[model samples]
Target: MAATPEGYMSGFGNDFETEALPGALPVGQNSPQRCAYGLYAEQLSGSPFTAPRGLNERSWLYRLRPSVRHTGRFDKVDLPHWKSAPCIVEHDRPIGQYRWSPVPIPDASLTFVAGVRTMTTAGDVNTQTGMSTHLYFVTASMFDDYFYNADGELLIAPQQGALAFVTEFGRIGIAPGEICVIPRGVKFRVELVAGAARGYMCENYGAKFTLPNRGPIGANCLANARDFKTPVAAFEDREATSRMTVKWCGKFYACEIGHSPLDVVAWHGNYAPYKYDLRAFSPIGAILFDHPDPSIFSVLTAPSGEEGTANVDFVIFPERWQVAEHSFRPPWYHMNIMSEFMGLIYGQYDAKPQGFTPGAMSLHNCMLPHGPDAQAFARASQARLEPEKLTKTLAFMFETRFPQRLTDYAATLETLQEDYADCWAGLEKRFNGKP
Candidate 1:
């Protein structure tokens, strides 16, 4: 297979070293009294100083100036559309299973930051234990504007065009079907690569996302570590006016600067941005006679401290086979405690085949009764018992332990599918009570 054009260092959670300039990184010791090339040494810690060695995450950066000098005084700015958790906005709408068509790209200019529209929020941003789902419609790039979220890490899944993420560590290019994670407090700017870009984002305010344990599967399949790519060291040595933005506690703040913040000439650590291709995901499903739980399809999970429970799980429904004999292959009907917010990147999801279009989203909050719609249930029940391939389809779920509250913007959207319940209306009372 051809390497990604942007290039990447393989492996997950491995201490990687990259330098834009040769001999720029110091040997052995992380910090020397006087750094080479008059660079400033700074440590960026993703975890606490006393965190266990296995969970510790920190990186050493050799940059033009310390990060403290990159910002001035901060002034609070309002982003009405982008909201955070514990946000139970009062609305007339009832809480039930709901779906919406793809939000249209704005006709006016909207940068990545300005384009973020939060649909639902779970947990609390201040407590840092939940997540939020957002849709970004980027028509303009952030030329001199840089941003970092102090409250959470971002998992971006593009559905329209490509994006070039120029970060303090390096640059990562992502398109539809590929996802990139920017760790908390990593300054970066989004640049549009394939014109305007539209995508879904999961802002996790809990533990960082990690590959799930393979258990009895023995780690040979599902999301392999080698497929997760962290970018090579890249930086800019330019002098120009720039603005740095900070998103903390659900509020936005900006500071003016004289140079780009992405000035790191070299960096080494496991705490950095990385991207993964969904197509590279090796999916495991029912090969015999029963449908497994969706947890079996999880690509990454952010734990909630409790064992087996996730603060959030990023689960994908990628192309796979269906060979369960005398079984209803589509997901069975049930109410779940975990709130599920699902999105389709492309093709038809077997569960809700008709109304769930690409770029569309649905929310099935805690204990909400939902499953395969009438059309899907009918088809799966009558299909022949043979190996079938579900191709060209990709869907994902951002399921959380906490209940998600819809934002006012989401509830008021014109594209909201008011008739979403109709998909299940045809599921007749077929229980004959005669086994």
Candidate 2:
């Protein structure tokens, strides 16, 4: 981990090195390879609902991965000089069923999930759950504050616009469709430049995310480590009164802290701020047989407890081939320890059809029972199982270990689609009474 400049320590905090995946994909292999199958096809057309591609187009063909984004103009905004309200609040009024309502962070201790919802319908609400996945989103402003999740890492996904992330180590900008991972306690903030922004924020309160044991898939499959990029050491020696937002025992609070939060004079561990573009993801598949499980596409993961358990897993189902003959082509229904909080950047999520849209979110708590709706299941069942190409759409998840509890703000937002809860209403029970 890189160290923060001299005096920035107390506010910025220290970051540890994340345990590298047991086997990381070699760097600079088949980089920027392009095909008509997944994200590439969508990028080629310049669509907002498309995924971000690696620095090059031919990302998949290369043996190693390429840099996800080319460095751009990164600005350092002096937060102390700007005027703002005291960064703290606790609300009691109920809003609606939308996640991004402006509610005061509750004063009473509570584990509430906070963040912006891009898209959703009733049956599927993407609840941020990685670790104790507590998410936050900023619109048209810079998040010049500090946050802590007790004992978990931070998973940040930006759905729209760009974030000029000014940590102690220089500045890195994450545009749409990009994910930034800040390890536990590493204080940072977001400065939005494009437009209104929203996405997932998971505050993992368990073991950090590590690559799942490939087991039968050998040590190599999805998410090669070298593909992950950590910013070079960048330090800031400025003095200012920045805000700090801490989530402790389920409640959000603010303190009148006066210092930059990206302070880690010097440290070494496996945790750091790394970004990944979904387009660079090399999808492993059961080409001639059937669609493999989503685990096969996990680019980064913060595991929870033991093996097969995850506090949060950042998984994507980008544009890819559908060549499974004589098999159901969409996601199958199953319950898992990790609750799933999903969102779409652009295009359709293969698992659902009509109601799901770009900027929509859905949450399927652990064991709550979820999958393709009845309409999707029926259509996919009768459709031809040919090698159909699914392109343009890019959807992802912030899967977590805890069952997410909706904040009053999210339970009552004006934009909250009231009829969405009925998405699964048409599902049928076909069990015969013969047992």
Question: Judged by TM-score, which candidate is best?
Answer: 1
- Report, for every candidate in turn, its global Cα lDDT versus the true structure: 0.91, 0.50
Residue 116 lDDT in model 1?
95
**lDDT by residue for model 1 over 114-192, one digit each (tens)?**
9999999999999999999999999999998889999999999999999999888888999989999999999999989
For candidate 1, report its TM-score: 0.98
Q: What is the C-alpha lDDT profile of model 2 across 1-435, one tens digit per residue?
A: 333321211101123221112212123332234421121110111112343432111111111111121112333322221111111224453322222222232233221123332221111112323343333455545334544433345567666556666543334567766776665544456565665555556555444555556668785656665555566444333345655555443334555444555542222323345666667767778777766778887876655445676656778888888888788888888776666777777788776786777666766766766788778888898997777888987888777555555543345455456565466677778679888
- Which residue window of length 10 is worst by lDDT in model 2? 58-67
TM-score of each: 0.98, 0.65
Relative to the unseen true structure, what is the C-alpha lDDT of residue 299 in candidate 2, on a scale of 0 to 100?
Answer: 71
